[model samples]
Target: MNIRKKVIFSFVILVAFIISISSLSMITTYHMKENSSFAKQVSRLINIQEDMNELINLVTIENSLEKLKNIKEKFISFENDFELLREDITKKDHKDLIDYILPNIRQNQNISKSLNNLFENEHAIELIFDDIYKFQNKHIYHNDLFSKIYPEENEKRKLLQELIFKTTNLKLIQEFGNLRYYSKETLYQHRDMETFQKWTNSIDEIILELRKNDRLKILPLFTGYKETVEIMGNLAINIHNIEKEEKILTTKLIKILKENRDESSSIEIKIEEVAEQFLSKISFIELILVITIILITIALTLYISSKLTSIIQKLNSGVKRLKDGDYSSTIVIKEDKEFSEIATTFNNMAQNIEEHQNTLEEKIKLRTNELQGALVNIQKQKDILENLSNKLAKYLSPQLFESIFSGKQDVQIESKRKYLTVFFSDIKGFTDITDSVETETLTEILNEYLDIMSTVAIKHGGTIDKYIGDSIMVFFGDPLSNGKAQDAISCMNMAIQMKEEMSKLRIKWQKDGISKPFHIRMGINSGYCTVGNFGSKNRLDYTIIGGVVNLASRLESNARPDQILISSETYTLIKDTIKCTKKEELQIKGIAHPIQTYEVISSGNNSTIIEEQTGFNLILDLNQIDKNNIINILKNTIIDVEKNI
Candidate 1:
């Protein structure tokens, strides 16, 4: 048969095995549950057996009517427990046991009720002693009065005294009290009818002797004594009867419990034996079925494995031939079984691969030459793009140019609020210089000066915003910053360096025959300003704007030539790193309040200008040396030099 039919047949057998195993498991589970339930019932019966034995003990040990009352409640509770037990006992053997135990339990309950009623009606056994004591006291009182009336030591008085201190009567009265019962146990201990008869006879003898004393008969106290003794005799006999009944019932209850215990043990053993036998049967059946399934599964696997091994070997031989460039090879299918379709498809694929091989080789040859030319063109385009990027860098500040090329900042018309230290500086007499000098010469000077200042600003990490005429605007704290304080300090240092550079340029210009060279005024301010690329998308300028920029420009206009002025905001930031003198507050345009200002001075690393020439050499740091002594010292040195010349 083909593989599909074989697989379908194998599935049918597996499903059959599954159904068989499941049915067996279900049956085993049902039987186990049955056995477990039977065990629980037996467990409950054993507990009832224990309770019944305990009830027998309660009846046997408890004889007092007061204690018997408590036992009466115990009897009721036991009855309740037994009734519940009876309902739960579904097993035939256990139910039979319950049937037997029920009648005996009822008998015990009746006995407890009888004991309770006996004490309730009879004022208990202590009343006998009380009656006897009252009779004895009356006899003593009357005997003494009779002896006083006669005043004679006679036989009659002697007999009356004999009755007063009667030993026989005292023994009868205190019998139960001496036994420490005086209640239910009084009758229990002396349960024999002979004991009651003895008590009665002793009372009869006392009355008989009292009748013999004619003088005592006339005494009212003597009559009362006789009647009291008679009442106690009756009370003792009645209490004895109640106690006898309790003992009989208790003995019967004990006998019944012993029988029930034996039955409980037998049932427990029988149930266990039955359970063991059932489990053994189930295990044996399951073992046989499991072995059958395993043997069948092994045979099925071997059949499929043998068929698969032969098919795979044949397919592998065909694949090896095809791999060795044997396109003419074809698989010869036998049995029309597994892998026949795969053999047909593999043959078709081999034919197609042979057909396309020549065309693929031709295409690869042509693509090789084409790819080389494209690579050369790609390299040329890359160099051209890099050169163009460098030219674009000239228009933007170095920081801004780097951000745009590095993909950190997007070139868009976007702006954000940032705290920047804005700087503005212009040549002191730029308009005069433009008119006095030739256009070519003036343009050269201006370019040279701008180049110097631009280098200083860029070196201090400022973004050169724009150059208006000879005026240059720059800002710090933009695309990147070392915080506001550092940005402000760097700007102040840049301004100071620019001022010093101007002094050097002045000397250079004098040598160039241009007597009055340019001086520059600079201003710096720190505050929140709008900074980013501003303008249309086609033409954008990465610069800053707002009131802080305007204030910086105003400070520059108000500054004196060769001076660097700054706002109070910038002063605070540069105070630690650079020396700045707080200046007078000035009211400027577009500002409601007076603007506080400061003059920039030397920094921590201030340098003195050292000028050396053919005729003069001057090295003076005004901040470091004594200025008052310098003028006379220079004069004396000049006079000595003049004599030598």
Candidate 2:
């Protein structure tokens, strides 16, 4: 278990132990008090039974009313005490004792009162006879004195009669609920009442006989006194009979008292034993509580502390491992309390972190591999594109190619009017020469001728637009431009170089055994023309088109072999840097009027010259050809030309 649960469980165990101890102690103590009270009551009841009996016996023997009066008070008090105690008793242990004893105490509560009644009867009988005895013993016998003293005796006897009536009446009420009266009718056939009737009849006969003996003057005072003495005697006998009946019942009462006493003693002993056992048990329980508390405290403390320390250490270790980047670390907990929950959460968190890290690492590795593959593929594609671009450069002008690839020009159907110098050149009678030669020889010668012309065109900063068969068109201006006049001059210079290169080719072709030589015609024009990509979206040609371009083609078509033609507009632009001669105003189809034209002769500074005679041409570039071989080559060229003719 975790620390919190261990502590709480320990506390609960301690509390339960404590409560058990307290509950047991309280129960034992309660029983002990009950048993203690029971024992005391048993002893007290025995004492009351003994003391009240002895006091009643003593009062009966003394026969003194004062003493009996005191005894009566005690009897009432003790009897009331017994009654209350009997009512208060609820224990089953003394059930027989209380049952036997309590009834006896109630039944005999009148014992002292019975004795007092006996004494009162005796006193009444004595008073009844006292006046007769005094009257008989009278010393002065004078008639007046005798009358006076005897009358006083009669008065005394009358008072004694009243005492008898009151005692007998009280006895009657005690026995039969108030039946005594001044009548001859007997309400009961009781023995004492019968004896009282007998005495009453005997005294009445003596009193009647004494009336004959009137000489007994005291007899006159004996009126109603006989009945008084008889009633007093009967009361005494009744009291004695009641005492005898009480005495007669006492043997059984004494036996019951003895049995009850034995029963009480047994109960008291049981109470004492129970109280002692409870007391000893309470002590034992206290000892057990202390020892159990100590054991539990030690056990729980060790268990909780060990568990707490170990779990904390494990948690701390986990934290340390995680902090050090050991994401694979985990913990094992067997307890299923709060700490187990925490450990589960922590384990889940750690597992998630580890899984996340693993997943992230795997993703990074996969992406890295993909990127490497992509780079390799991209490099391969780049190599293919570069090769394609190199091959494509041969078809497009370098200026247009560079501009488009360099992001300087947008490849779209767009054009602008730029004043450009345009040039067109073609072989003279190229079809007739082709029909005379073999196809392979013609092909080699045409390629050789076009290669020479293209080299000259590029070297002069002209963009080679396209070539149709043996014809070539070139232009200067955008995508790059110097000036309109400079463009025109550059074109003229390029044409002149072409003528010189042709002269050299003619000599080389003759040496290769060609029976015919090729001559080229060139045309130049300068004007505004639309120049840009011209075609559909999928395919485009970076070239020029307009009247200027058409005019250049026209000029080339009209020129003679080995001749250069120039429009007036182009001649004006190149006049300062080139040598041209006016030819004629040739009528062009698309023009409203005829246009002026010229023949290009040479550069303002001529670097070379090539001349045509009747059957041969002479070519020389003193600045280009080796000085030592020039004369021999010229004399050799003259012989070869004449031989060919």
Every candidate's lDDT: 0.68, 0.69
Q: Estimate TM-scores for all models.
A: 0.50, 0.45
lDDT of candidate 1 over 17-94, digit per residue (tens): 878877876745644564566567546645654554464455444434455456546645655665565555422322
Model 2 alpha-carbon drift over 4 Å, by segment: 1-324, 328-351, 612-618, 624-645
- Cα-lDDT of candidate 2: 0.69
* lDDT string, candidate 2, 1-645, tens digits: 456766788889889988888787664444445445655654665576666656545543443445555665785576677656645543233323333422211122232233234233323323322332222222112223434444453465555455334434443223222113321233123436665565455556545544554525445445646544554454444544545544544454455456555555555555555445445645776897889899989987887778778888888999899889887788776754777778878878987898799789999999999999999999999999999999989888888889889999998998889999999999888888877889998899889988988998889999999999999999998788989888888889999999888888987898797867778998888999999889999998888999999999999888998899999899888887788889988888897888898998989668686776546657766668887788788789889979999
Candidate 2 has which clashing residue pairs, if any?
none
Candidate 1: stretches off by over 4 Å: 1-307, 337-341, 357-378, 406-419, 430-445, 479-485, 507-518, 526-537, 545-551, 572-577, 582-597, 604-645
